[model samples]
Target chain A: MKIVITASGEGLDADMDSRFGRAKNFIIFDTETKEVSALDNSVNLNAAQGAGIQAASNAAETGAEVLISGHCGPKAFRVLKEAGIRVYNTEAKTVRQALDLFLQDKLVESSGSDVEGHW
Target chain B: MTIAFASGKGGTGKTTFSVAFALSADDNVTFLDCDVEEPDSHFFIKPEITGNEKITVPVPVVDSGKCTGCGRCAKVCRFNAITMLGKKPLIFHELCHSCGGCSIACPEKAVSEIQIGTGVISSGIRDHISFYQGLLDIGNTKSPPLIKAVKKKGDGASLVIIDSPPGTSCPMVTALKGADYTVLVTEPAPFALNDLKIAVETVRILGIPFGVVINKSDHPFPQTEEYCRKEAIPVLLKVPEKRAAAEGYSSGESIIKIFPGLGDEIKKAISTIKKEAVR
Candidate 1:
């Protein structure tokens, strides 16, 4: 299974980003192959509006089965759930630790968005 | 002729002076409170609303039966108001700018537009003044559409006084877009002067004939006056601050009642604006 972790930098050692919509980068991890690839999310940072919706679409397009971020917004959560992707809300200090927690089943799947979408 | 009153700084007497101008005018003047978010001029005008209607914006609605799951509609939306998941697009109307891009991008003609009410525009009369105002629904983010509707209500009036919202952004531009003249209300204070410079830049960019109205001018802040003089902008009116006027404003009385002498000053300001707008 592929898992996506929102990160502040491009790699396993980068800090886990607190925000999911305007996150700086995404670190995709392939559990079976132990492969790591970075997806830059800088384009959505200054988006005039609906950054969460665009970010959700981007995360789903990466073919990740699960997304791990500190917080998820309502609109983004709906999109991910519709795309058959599950989000795990966490405050893990770094991407490496988040992956470990996910493997150990220490992260809880978010039933709904923890934050409201900004208009 | 249409004249808009705007102050980049909030609470600098934009509504006060504009309402005063409309009341002092000898002819039947239309008053539009384009500050849909707050719409405070209605408190001053006390208009007897004769007509009111909801204003709406068009947002995309996808036809699930006709959609091809191609995600073209989602791709074409600049505002990301539409997002496709599992071959279906979810429309977020709040984020929609009503550009109709998704409808245009649909290949199978699955996308259609629907109207969602964002606010209400009202029109009526207060004596010789024809009054109009837009009241944005609480928690609704779309205001430009409502402001436009309010402005439309005052169309064809010989004299129109538009009280625009503060800040030089979309709302302000919508109000001042085609005005014959703009009165940039300001005060001789630090924060007011800072915003006044930006407001001046906005009007200059729009190429609208504009003058400054310095409220609370008795203050010793000579910087505002000096800046206007150096820029060659006309100081249309200098209304000294008065406690009596403030008391009258709180009680919802016409400003002319508090300061009877102000009627002549408003008349003079109108003449100067007419002369400048003509050129």
Candidate 2:
């Protein structure tokens, strides 16, 4: 299973970014092979609006089944759920810690968006 | 001639000047309240509304049967209003700008445009002035379309007066567009002077001729006058601040009626604007 974690940097030691839509980078990790890759999300960072929906589209295009982020907005959550991607809300310190939490099944799956649309 | 009254700061007396000017101007004047978020010209004009129409914008509606989810609509949407998830296009109405790009880009012609109400434009008459105002729906952020709709009603009037929204953003620009002249209202405070400079820059960029109207002129502030002189911008009128005038304004009374000689000053300003507009 592929898992996408919102992060501020590319390395495993980099802190997990709390913002989902405007995160600096998204780290994609494969649970079986443990292969990691980084996708830049700077385009949506300065967007005047609709950053969440654009970020959700980026996540969907990545073919990741799971999303681990500190927060998810309403529009992004709806799009991810429709794409059959399960979203987990987490406050893990680092990207590696968030991956471990997901592997241990300790992360809480969000039933709906934890934040408002624009937040 | 269309005259737009604009200010960079709110509560700087744009509506007050607009209402008073419309009342004092010739009989064939049209007053357009372009401040859709808070249409307050009616408070002073008290127009008897004769017509009201809903202002709408086109939003894409997807037909699932014809949609193959090729992601064409998603690709064409600059606003990110459409996203394809599992062979289905999800439409976010709030983010839609009614550009119709999605429908045009759709290969299967599955995307259809549907109109959604964003506000209402009402037309009426108060004495000799024909009044039109746009009222934006609560929580609706699209205001330029409604402002355009209100301005459309001013075509036949001999003189059009637009009460523009505060700030130098899109709505204010929409109000100032195609205006023959602009009357910038501001106070003599520091913040007002700062914002007035911004407003002046905006009008200058649009290449519209504008003059300053200093409200609350009784307050002793030399900075505003000095700035106007340095910029070579004409000071069309200066309305003195009075407790009785403020009290009358709060109670929806026309300041022209309360202050006897003020009407002549407004008329003189109009003639000056007309002369400047020709130059």
Candidate maximizing lDDT: 2
Q: What is the lDDT of residue B211 in candidate 2?
A: 99
Off by over 4 Å in 1: none
10 residues in a row with least lDDT, candidate 1 chain B = B84-93
In model 2, what are the clashing residue pairs, if there are any?
A: none
Specify the highest-DockQ model's number. Answer: 1
Candidate 1 local lDDT, B171-263, one digit each (tens):
998888888899999999999999999999999889899999999999999999999999998999998889998998998876778887798
**What does TM-score give for chain A of every model?**
0.96, 0.97
The number of the candidate with the highest TM-score is 1
Q: By summed lDDT, which 10 consecutive residues of candidate 2 chain A come out lowest?
A: A45-54
Instruction: For each candidate, give the TM-score of chain B.
Output: 0.97, 0.96
Docking class of 1: medium
